[model samples]
Target: MSSQSRKKWTGYAITSAIIISLMIITIGIYSFEEENLKNIITKNQVEIQEIITKSISKNISSELELITFELALLAESGQLQDDLGTKESNQLISQTFDRLNSISPTAQILALDKDFKVLSQASKIHNSFVGATVKGLPDLIDSEENKTKSESKILSINTSLFDEPEIAITFPIVNKETNISNGLLLVTLPSSEFFKRHGNIYDVESQFLMVMDENNVLLIHPNMENVGKNFFDDEIQHDISYNSALNEYITHVLEGNLSTVIVTLEDNIGERINSAIPVTVNGKNEFVFGVVTPTQSINQEIDEIIFLTKIQTVFLLMSTIAVLLVFMLKRSQSFKKEKLTVIGQLSSNIAHDIRNPLGTIKNAGVIIEKENNSQNKIISREINRINLSVRRISHQIEEVLNYVRTTPMILKQHSISQTIQEAVDTLDVPPDIKINIPNNDVSIRIDHEKMLIVFVNIVLNAIQSIGKNEGNVTISIRETFSNVTIEFENSGPNIPAKDLKHIFDTLFTTKLEGTGLGLSSCKNIIEQHKGTIHVVTNPVMFSIKLPNEHSNTE
Candidate 1:
């Protein structure tokens, strides 16, 4: 392939590679950021769930101990030695019950007979419990001595008067004088009451509090209907157990172990993190208190961080691309300018070396043609052709030298009409080619010597393009407020559109004898004078615009 074609394809490949590389880098960054954000959010959620679980369990445990403290104090005070089923004893016990009930209305204080039958009860829900039997109680009298060391023993009880599961504490009652057991005192309270009170006391929102018995039966929940339900026996919605891995994790929770796990649920609640903690009853790990809350709250701050990170990433990428583009563009221009400088230096050296030798050769050819006699007619004719060839080479070398010349412009106010006429006088004009210039004088800022070179090249090119045919070269000057435009239009055969586009490119030409630098040199000269030159091919014309001398506007 040609050098030009190779350069074009190489540029295309480099551009494509840069674009693909940028895309890959952007996608890789996005994926890495997304995964990192997810990991951070998941870790934060686990920590929050564990913290909430511990806080809730500690609060509930302390509250339950307060009730235990009250009961223990009463039992150790020696105030319950009266006979059973007596009116006076009932009145005395009723007064104590009223005092305890005033402190915590949710609690029901009762006196029980030896047969585990309730004798007198003071409660908010049940009006009377004169002779009701309590079910789901262990035979505490059998191991009375072993359990009696402590005033209160925790147990679960279900009675006809209760709505859901209840936590019952049993203590043996003794006479202060004889030290003998007379009856048992029990304090029963709904497990739901503790959960509800916890919600009101604390400011935890969107959290579901639950308490379950050792048998895996749910004793308390935010939802009232869920109370007294067995998690293992009842059907649950969106249970994580469908997945074996999740079920294994849940197994730890059911075994009364402190565990935090993520679970999905229906009803717009979406995903949640569950934290369960074990509570001891009857000196055994027999209850689990859990807090269930949505994961959104845990990740709310993380979401904002991720959003800002993505925006910053995009902004940084765009800024980097813009900076890279600007750097590349400036570098390309610098490289081109450096190349042109080197070519100019080299051309000046070569032109100086070749011009002297060519001048000597031309003189020799001229002497041979002038001194040859009629007998050496063939020799003289050949010498004439040699001189012509030498002249052609000199002209070609001169064109190259002109193309590389980098001279600073010497600005002066000059008459446009006079400059055009002087350029025309220097050109080898044919009589058949009619040339016309405006008589009016228009002043413009220009380098007069360089302007002469520009007009001469354009006029010569026009004449040569017309060949041996009759053509008119008309010069029309159009002056605007800020610019003076001179157009050289010729009636020559039009140049091809494809060729016109590159008419001023270095080393580009359509003529066989052309050095391809004539028009290019003209363009350089015009641009040095802070002017512009362009061409149109319909009738083969060149237009030049220079800044008006009297105009201050740019």
Candidate 2:
């Protein structure tokens, strides 16, 4: 491979490596930052949900306490101490329970006599608890009879028709004068109304509110189908392992702990961020309140951060590559300038030294030819040969100097036909060779002196390629809308395909006596005039295109 091609591939490899490294670094940074951002967002979300849950729990506890206080006051006023399960006593308790339900919508309220048999029960939905004895009372009844305080309790009932669980708050009905217990008031608040009313209090719609009893049973859920169900039930959770883990977490929350975790579910709700907080009444754990949110919602802010970071990384990568390209180009220009300066100095020194010796040799040959005696034609012919050799050497030296010359263009408008004629006049045409040119006069912009050198070199190259004194050299000038083209065709031997491609390359030649710089110098001069020059093989023709007057100015 050439040095130039090797350098090109090397540059590409380095650029590709740089791009890949930048991408890897950017991705690494994004991954690290994304993890930290998710943690921060999840932590902040948990804290915010905790605050909301605590507030709702506090409000509900206070409201239930107030109701119990009102019921205790009724007992103290002797309204609940009438004949046990009597018509008048049932009427009074029923009237008071109806008033309470109208205001707060209690699910069920039962007034039980001293034997724990229900006297009057007021329920929004169920109808069988009015006269039946309450079963869960003995487990929850206070052993200390003098205790005048109301207490809240949770219970799970086996109902054949209803799927709802119950949490009832009980207060003893006592006589104020005797300081004795008379009956008990049990109030069961509906989990649905309780959860629905307070769940929507916060403005966060992405999260769903849930309530669970102390037994890990779901008292309220966003999906009503799961209400009053245990967290470990297969109907509620299909994944056995996940259900076991979730039950463990629920038990932890019911034991009065607060936590957050990620869990998978089967209800089309994939991964979720679950925050469990416990609600308390009378300074004791009553139930657990949980806030469940989808994982995508929790990480939304982090996703946005990653997006912005990626955009910035892309911009930075492009900017860096552009800067590097500009820097490399500037370096290449500096190296080229240094190389050109050395070549110019060397060419000037070599041309100056060789020209003096060549001039002396040519002068000596010419003087010897003049002074030779008439009797010896041999000596005169030898002197003539010496002079010819000197001229060829001088021409080769001049070609070398011209090839190394780096003259800037000094453009002016010149007549194209006139310039061609001038260049043809400078060439030594044999009497046997035919020369042809068009008479049309067209003008174009060019550096006259340089373009003349180009025309002289190309015409001479075509003539020499014929290798005979009897061939034709035809010159034609044609004009186009934007350019003027000059073509030179000679009846010369066809150039080999392999040699034709490199004909205009510096230091390239096919002839034994050729200096090799004539055509290359012609190419350089034509290019300096903001034009192009090329050759064809069949007729050994050269074509030159020069910009017209209007094109040059534009």
Candidate 3:
């Protein structure tokens, strides 16, 4: 090859290699970031699971304690000490049980004889176990084989009768003077209560939860089919066998150590992520709660993020390439200079058009006010109204003029509190109306005069809405690193829903005498300052946001 051709070929090769290397580096960094993000998400899921577990357990335990306290009070009272056969005693017990059942939907309250024959039951009647002697009592009474004990002596027996997937807590009803145990008061709470209460507290969708006894008997599964089923049985044999995930979960729980694990299960729908936390109940490591969220849900979020990142990266790369090409071409650009000159001429024309008519109206109103005669009272009142209308029109015209006149300029920060006070001072608000300002000073970068117009417009609108009713207007200002937000909230009749969207449109008026320009003018001023303005019709809240900066001294 010729020397020139060889050099060209070499250059092309080098460029291609550089491009490939950069692509590989970018992909590697993205992969690493994605993996790190996944780990962080998993960690958060585990933490949330732990929180849900602890919260649910504490709530249930609190409910149980409250129930026990109430029962203890009833048992100690002289009312129930007379006899179980009496009409009055039966009525009291029935009323008390009904109240308990209403408050705790998952609990079944029972008054049983000393031999554990049920006198009454709170839940629906089932033929399998009602009126039968309690079968699970002996095994739970601190027996050597049971490997579990109760903290409160009153809760010595676990009569969670018939493998019905409920938490059975038995407290002995004692005679006060004799100090002798008479009958057992049993409360059976289903595990569904924990799931329902947890669901109400958090907004996450789809959770599968389970509670098991120390022997791994599945006492409660939020899924009704799993209730009255033992985890060690053939159908659920996989859950109880050693080395299995559920077995490991139970072991950690029974050891009194909290553990959170994420297990993936395949079902008819698809693979799902399950987060589990083990909780100790009544001194037995028998209950485990798990929340299942679909992997598809989290995967959807990841996919959206990836798509956005790719789009942003492509745009950024194109911008960088464009800048490089422009620099290489070495062209002198005067586009901004030409644009400014045209803008300046247009602004001068707009200002002249606005100011001339405004001045004419003001002068005409003033001349009318000066005229005095036998009809002076009527003339003066009409002149005053005309002057007010002229002022409103002039303010709106000035807002447009300012927008046309001001060039791209840096905003000077000023005291927002002072500006708002000045705006309020300009309004003819009724004395019955109350206005509240925040205690702290709010500072923001904005044109002081333009900002004044915004506040005045919002406040005037609020005062007009109040009319004759006792009203309150509250102003709150908050600042952050990037932006400052000011909110004006008022209590009055709510703005009509149909008019809400049109309120900010130019020349949209709700009142007969209004110039229909206040809100529109306010919107223009905010946009010119690179800020945003929004109105919330319900409760009549208006908010404005501006850039944050150090306050200007003057």
lDDT of each: 0.67, 0.69, 0.61
Task: Give the higher-TM-score candidate: 1 or 2.
Answer: 2
> How does residue 409 of candidate 1 score in lDDT?
72
Q: Per-residue lDDT of 289-388 in model 1, one digit per residue for the tens?
A: 7777776764575456445444554444773554344335534654664455445444544454565467567767766766775459789778867876
| Per-model TM-score versus the true fold | 0.45, 0.46, 0.49
The reply for model 3, stretches above 4 Å from the true place, is: 1-15, 120-164, 204-207, 220-227, 232-246, 262-286, 292-300, 315-554
Between prediction 2 and prediction 3, the one with superior lDDT is 2
Greater-TM-score candidate between 2 and 3 = 3
Model 2 stretches astray by more than 4 angstroms: 1-21, 83-103, 121-162, 177-180, 203-207, 221-226, 230-248, 264-267, 299-313, 317-554
How many clashing pairs per prediction, in order? 0, 0, 1
> Cα lDDT of model 2 overall?
0.69
What is the TM-score ranking, best to worst?
A: 3, 2, 1
The number of the candidate with the highest lDDT is 2
lDDT of 2 by residue, 73-160 (tens): 5555445665556677666666767766643557667888777888877665777676688775766455323334444344544444
Steric clash pairs (candidate 3): 165-219
